[model samples]
Target: MNHARKVHIALNVTDVNRSVEFYRTAFGVEPVKWKPGYAKFDITEPPLNLTLNHQANIEGKGALNHLGIEVSSTAEVLAAKQRLREAGLEVIDEMNVDCCFALQDKIWITDPDGYRWEIFMVKVQDTQPDLTVPQGQHLQACCRQ
Candidate 1:
């Protein structure tokens, strides 16, 4: 038997309305479901489900951790980049970048609440030895203490 499941990601925000507006403008989609203090957007084209909830305090909640959306092709990633830039959101290009021992073409952006989000296409997966530079190469270690 083959089964499929939907992915849902919930993000806490100070204001649901503001977050909704940002997401709507950025993704070019409206939330299919919305209620007081809660909203759900079913991003159709990319098949992502996003939920936003109002919360006064998110500190120490691990809410700032990064999340990513992987697309099928590099062109899609570039399209998203253009859309995001046109919406006046801060879009960063990390094209042909190497991270976690894999090569990817990606864009990184931060939401209103400062959570890092990455939209990327995996160009190739690395199987060779890690090429990451050693600590202190850039005057400090890359990894945190």
Candidate 2:
């Protein structure tokens, strides 16, 4: 089987500078490339690529549904939460939470456009037989209820 490589996430936003500031404060990194209407950050210490683009109708488009970043340990997750809070950003904690048949410790935040983002540490992987059902059910159930 071919191995999957790196993943890049492109996010559309209303203002590049504001989004850049939010991400920089939240993730503790600076964009490697930045221009008038675009910015890109290599969040590889956490192994993720984050890109931001400026557009007029970012809110109307609903460009970002939600995205997740998984860290190495629960301490890292809590640390991230504290950092965000210190920057005057709201961070939602969901520790010991069951989702997709596995237990996770996580924190949630939203960007300026109200796009949900999750930073988490996976403590256990579930060996469930019905993967699809569990995945869908968990996403719906966990956030709402």
Could you give candidate 2's per-residue lDDT for residues 67-137 as a string of tens digits? 76767788888999999999999899999987534477889888897767787765765434233322112
- The C-alpha stretches of model 1 lying farther than 4 A from their native spots are 1-64, 127-145
Q: How much is 112 displaced in model 2, in angstroms?
A: 1.2
Best by TM-score: 2
TM-score of 1: 0.48
lDDT score for residue 55 of model 2: 59
TM-score of each: 0.48, 0.49
For each of the candidates, give the backbone clash count: 0, 1
Distance from true location, Cα of 137 in model 1, Å: 20
lDDT (C-alpha, whole model) for all candidates? 0.63, 0.65
lDDT of 2: 0.65
Best by lDDT: 2
Report how far residue 122 has shifted in candidate 2, in Å. 0.6
